[model samples]
Target: MSTEIIYQTLAILLGFAGLIWSADRFVASSASIAKNLGMSTMTIGLTIVSLGTSAPEVLVALSASLSDSGSLAMGNALGSNVANIALVLAITAIVAPIPIAKQLFKMEAPFLVGVTALLGLFIFNGELSRLEGLILLLLIPVFLWLVSRTQTGVEQEEIERSEGFKTFAWFIVSLAILIGSANTLVWGAKGVALTLGVSELLIGLTIVAVGTSLPELAASVASALKGHHDIALGNIIGSNIFNIIAVASIPGVVGPLAIDPDILSRDYYVMAGLTALLVIACALTLKRRGSKLGRSFGVVMLSSFCAYYYFLV
Candidate 1:
């Protein structure tokens, strides 16, 4: 490899590590602050934690867009959604079968589908306009409003004011790290793409997307292993939704982003198919009164993921 490629590879590795580590810390501190402020567990999980989990993608989108690589940002959003389900959720299901909560599925699935359809409509014309981006951003508050209504009955415990202040400080520090690391990651990714003579969209879809998705993979597996099945599935759903609306919108808001044909023809279809498969898999489990998604289904998901990657290559 050339000297530049070596340096770029190192940057990608270091940036990924920093991104993952700081993102975790940021989310933890944010959740602590929210809890200290008397937010319920469900509300925190749905709003703060969900957004926190998606921070990497959001920051990366901003970084890539600012760098004038808007197609890369769009690829990251779409490709991350594909990876979140096909790779992350697949691995998590295999770790331990995830149980589908009927209520959670019913409430969130429609919103996910709705947002996905909205994204499709916007992109069908081959470009995302600033107005469309703003429209997508406007839906965020509506999503939060719907989330607030489904408050769980869990009681909030009080925390010391000093502890809350400390968490807030951590939040700020980690957030700064997140921003820096995202820019670093984007720089490395663009470098690698240039060296490899691949399009920025390809790099974003393959390398950058999977790297940014590591947190989701880890979180889903841990949740599944710990028997927090709802959390495992919920995290994937929430992250995918954010990728579609929030992350994808950055390019449009920054400047008009032309849609890559492969994104619509390949990646988007794969993502939508996997999402439908998930809905079907969970829906089948719901018939058994929220039974678990079995190892067999997991194997199928893994197989599909492998097949998709093979097709990509």
Candidate 2:
């Protein structure tokens, strides 16, 4: 191993740690603020926490796209979806099978499918244009409106959120760390990829993708363990939605570029399939008296994820 490669490897490791911690800090502070502000768990999970967790991907997308590495951008946008489902959710389910929240099952779950379908349509031509990006951005508010309706019967809680000023201050600090760590991660990923004689897309698909996705993993797993099922399940669904519409839009707004053909034929389908699988899981589980994501399902997802990595290797 060369000296530069070693340094890059260290950077990636440090980058992952930084991104994950900052993401957790951001989500905790944001959730507390939302709860304190009179939002229900459902609303907090879907809107505040979800968007907070996906902040890394949004920034990384803008950074990569503006640097004229659209393929890298595409890889990060799509690859993270696969990681979120196959790795993050899978591991969470295996550790403690996540129960589908009732509100989430009805609204956010279906909305996730709709958003994914819309994103798929945009990239169908293997290119995302500025106009296309504008359309995606427009859909976010629409999605938020739909999400708002889902919390109709849910009652908001009023918490004092002690140390409100402190939480807000920490949130800002964490946000800064998230942005800087993401830049370091992407830079190290591209560097390591070049050293290994691989394309930036490949780097984004695996290393960069997983590194950026650490936030989702940490947030989801922590939520699941703490039995915040709404936030746990919603985080994955919301982040994936953000990944598609928000992350996908960055390249278009920054500088429209063609998506890789491999993504259309291979990567996009994998992402879509995993999403469909999740939708089906929710359907089958939600219909029962008490729904649960069993360890068996986790095994299936994890197996597929491992196979994907093996194939990539």
Candidate 3:
């Protein structure tokens, strides 16, 4: 390969490493803060943990948008959501099956579907305008407020435990790493796409999306291993919501993004389908505690992801 290729490869590797480290630091800080505040683990998982893990996706999409690769930016957002459910959750389920909560089925899962449907509607016209972006951005604060208001006393205590000066410091450091790594990853992904004669959309759909989603993989796996199935489920669901409403919204808010209408007609619809499948799977598995996600479910998820990848490439 050429020197440019080598530099790009190195940048990609460094970016991945930075993302993992940042995620770890963010999780630790969040956990510590929660512990200090006597917050419930579930609350911590739902809020701080979810936000921290989803930071890389936000950063990556923002960088891609700013760099003028609208397709890649949107692809990363949508693709990451698909991967979070199909790949990350599948792998976690295979490793250690997570039990589903009834509340999740009734509330969060439906919310995910709603946000995804809204996303499809927003992009249906082939462009995400500044006004639409602002609307999406506005939803973040409302969501946060709702979470704060609805979280139980135990959850609040957990959040307080995790809150402290050190936690704030870690958050700052993680934010810096998230920004730097996103830039590096986008640059590297663009280089690779050019070198291989592939579209940036393919790179975003596969490499960039997968690299940034490592945080979700890590968080979910950790939760699964710890026998906190609810945490594992919550992480994936929360991240997907954030990916659509927050990460994907940033680009259009900063500036209008012109998208291929096919994304709505094709990819977005596929995403909705996959999300529905996830909800069904969760519902089916709700009655069993500590039960392994059967091989069939894993195979189905993996198969769906593979099919999506093939279509993208």
Clashes per prediction? Answer: 0, 0, 14
- lDDT by residue (60-164, candidate 3, tens digit) is 778778888778778888888889988988888778866666666545777788888888888888889988888887877776665555445532222234448
Instruction: Quote model 1's TM-score.
Output: 0.82
TM-score, ranked from best to worst: 2, 3, 1
Q: Pairs clashing in candidate 2? A: none
Clashes of 1: 0
- In candidate 1, list every pair of residues with a backbone clash: none
lDDT of model number 2: 0.79
Model 1: how far residue 181 lies from native, Å = 6.0
**True-structure RMSD, every candidate:** 3.6, 2.4, 3.2
* Model 3 ranges with Cα > 4 A deviation: 16-28, 153-186, 288-295
lDDT of 3: 0.75
Q: On residues 1-313, what C-alpha lDDT tens digit does candidate 2 reach at each position?
A: 8899888888887777887778667666766776666666667677777787678788778878888987887788889999999998999899888776566676788877887888789889878889988888887898788887877667543433747789889878876786567667767777887876988788878887887777777777766765566677777888888888888788887767798888888898899999999999878887885869878889999999999888877
Greater lDDT among 2 and 3 belongs to 2
Write candidate 1's Cα lDDT for 232-266 as tens digits: 67678878888888999999999888988998888
lDDT of candidate 2 at residue 122, scale 0 to 100: 85
Better of 1 and 3 by lDDT: 1
Candidates in order, TM-scores: namely 0.82, 0.90, 0.84
At residue 225, give the lDDT of candidate 2.
68
